[model samples]
Target: MAVFLTLVLGSLAARATLADTWPAAIACGLALMFTLTGIAHFVPGMRRDMIAIVPPPLPAPALLVTVTGVLELMGAVGVVYPPTRADAAGCLFVLMLAMFPANIYAARMPDPPASMTANLGLRSAEEAVYLAAAIVVAVRGGQ
Candidate 1:
């Protein structure tokens, strides 16, 4: 939210072209979020929780999470480049979908904290919003 607002405000302040501002802002906001969450993969407790949530089918859970983190950061970089923005958004859209099983698995776990259970719902909504943003960015990137 902050990233989106900042992008919108910055675009307005700079008097950016209408066609570019809106879509660029959406892509940039998601980029910021992806970067932050990718960084979160390194924090101990968060990292443990992240590793815990991986669905069993994917091999090398820890490595996978690390790789995703790297990809998120790379996507963040790609999103800022007009030429690669659509491709980045598409990859991220798929990334979000790929991560859904972890959210579902976490939601089903009998964690003692109620907040933990609810977090999955919140994440699901967030992922949906991001996915939508990605779609918008992809479409607008070609314009």
Candidate 2:
């Protein structure tokens, strides 16, 4: 819900202040969304929730969270840069795919963290929306 709202509101703000084109607005939205989420990785509560969601099989969950957070931050920067927008969007799409298993793991856990407890179906739908938005930014944002 936060991601969707950020994208929509950010797009509107971008349209007003950044560019009038949908591609540009969407790119700005993606960048804003990523920036917010990326920062959440370092916040104590959110970081704990993020780490808790990582599949147990993946060693160094904390490190993985940190690394992915950094990647998200970098992607946020890249997505708004004209030269790197499409490439960044593509990478973010792949990143979303890569991170989904953790969401599944969290959903299946008997007692998931409160922050990560969205049901599998809802989480999947959210992921689909995010992926679709990323695709839109990737395919047309370069313009």
Candidate 3:
């Protein structure tokens, strides 16, 4: 829900305040979404939830979370800069793919996080939308 809301509201705001193009709006939305999610990595409770979602086999979940968070922040910045928008969107697309397994793992757990408790199908659909948005931003954003 957070992702959807962030993307929709951010895009709308961007459309109103920034460029009128859909690509520009999506780029802004993606940046805002990544910024929020990246910041969550440093928040105690959200950090715990993120770490918990990492598959058990991954060593040093905390470190991994921090690294991904930094990457997300970097992507956010890169996405908004015209010169780097495509590359950043491509990286974010890959990042989302790479991180999906953890989401699946979290959803399958007997007691999933409140955020992850949404049905797996719903989560997958949301991820698909996010990926599509990234692709749109990559292909047409900042043009």
Candidate 4:
């Protein structure tokens, strides 16, 4: 199932024109990001990086990181599930929206990371990707 979904979406990403390509790129990006992050959950440096990216008000950074990792994994899995791709896309959309504040916070804070500005732009691009994926899912009657 995973292989088939990846192939179909991957092909779409590679061959589709701009209109069709955006959503496929978004889906591929979301899938790859989730799969990688899911693996990174167990890495010490990545765990810390995740913590830093999340906002200050959030307590127990480790726990939040774990939860986020789990959600990403689930969403990635759902994206490959023919019965649940849309639901997964919706979940990802909400997750992206929920995390936007943290990205903005990181971008605007004084003494932010050297990459913070770029990270913010990347995060916005990611959000746009999700929105594009959502539109694709809707148009195709995903799930």
Candidate 5:
């Protein structure tokens, strides 16, 4: 997901533009993506899967999970505004880093669901991609 996001945004950014609309589009896409994912997290069976990904010691951290989801949703919404998109992307990057522990935990845990391993590897790569995208957006967004 992150990798895909990065690729899409990077491709868009490579072009010359007279307006900031490209960055705006990138921000809007990211915001929508995160907002939708956050919504999915609250669906009935989804919570358990999320808990499983977190460290065992934090298994029941419902509040923390909810807060993170809200933040993700908010960040996405915030990114759509031209005045806030760059900062919002930066915020999203920090959020991405903050939530990475859960992914690492899931990857290292013994025998996660059959699909978990593949998902973890994919997400790890995705994170790298998103990081690069965020950097690009941050550096070139205001131009």
Candidate 6:
């Protein structure tokens, strides 16, 4: 969720502000994406899957998982406003970093689920791309 949000937000922020720089489209896409995934947080089956990914170091895994979904909702809303885009992207970037361990832990699980990002390499690439995109969005959004 964080990676996808940051990637879309950053991609928009990287472009020029003078024209229709595609930020609006990307942001909208991200908003939609997060909305679906956020909803998934509440689904019992999905929640179980999420529980499997929670890192032990985190004190409140369940709460942390729930809060992340809420944050994604907030990020989706924040990315829609031009004045808030940069800050939203920056925050999303940090969120991605924070949640990365979950990806790592999940990858290490035996018979890790059959998701496209179930492996360490794929998850790492996903985070890397998202981080770059977030940087671009933050840098170009204000221009």
Q: lDDT per model, in order?
A: 0.73, 0.91, 0.90, 0.64, 0.67, 0.70
What is the per-residue lDDT of model 1 for residues 10-109, given as tens digits with 9 covering 90 to 100?
A: 4354335433467776766766677777887777777777888787778998998898888888887888788999999889889888878887888877
Alpha-carbon RMSD, each predicted model: 3.8, 1.1, 1.1, 6.0, 3.8, 4.3
lDDT of 6: 0.70
Error of 3 at 37 (Å): 0.4
After TM-score superposition, the amount by which residue 12's alpha carbon in candidate 6 deviates from its true location, in angstroms, is 10
Ranking by lDDT: 2, 3, 1, 6, 5, 4
**Per-residue lDDT tens digits of candidate 3, residues 6-124?**
98899999999986798888899999999998998898988998999999999999999999999999999998888999889999999999999888998788888775544788889
Q: In model 4, what lDDT does residue 121 have? A: 73
Residues 1-143, candidate 4, lDDT per residue (tens digit)? 24234534663664464324444445554565567657676577767666776788888878987887798788878765657766777787787678677678777676665434436676676557556665565345262
TM-score of each: 0.80, 0.94, 0.95, 0.70, 0.76, 0.78
Q: What does the lDDT read for residue 113 in candidate 5?
A: 48
Best by lDDT: 2
Arranged by TM-score with the best first, the candidates are: 3, 2, 1, 6, 5, 4
Model 6: per-residue Cα lDDT over 1-143, one tens digit each: 45465446554554344236665555554555556667777777777778768878778778887999899778877766888987887887788788888888888887665542676887797678666656666677545
Q: Which has the higher lDDT value, candidate number 2 or candidate number 5?
A: 2
lDDT of 2 by residue, 1-143 (tens): 78778988998899999677888888899899999999999999999999999999999999999999999999999999999999999999999999999999998899988877469998898788889878988999887
Model 3, 19: alpha-carbon shift in Å? 1.5
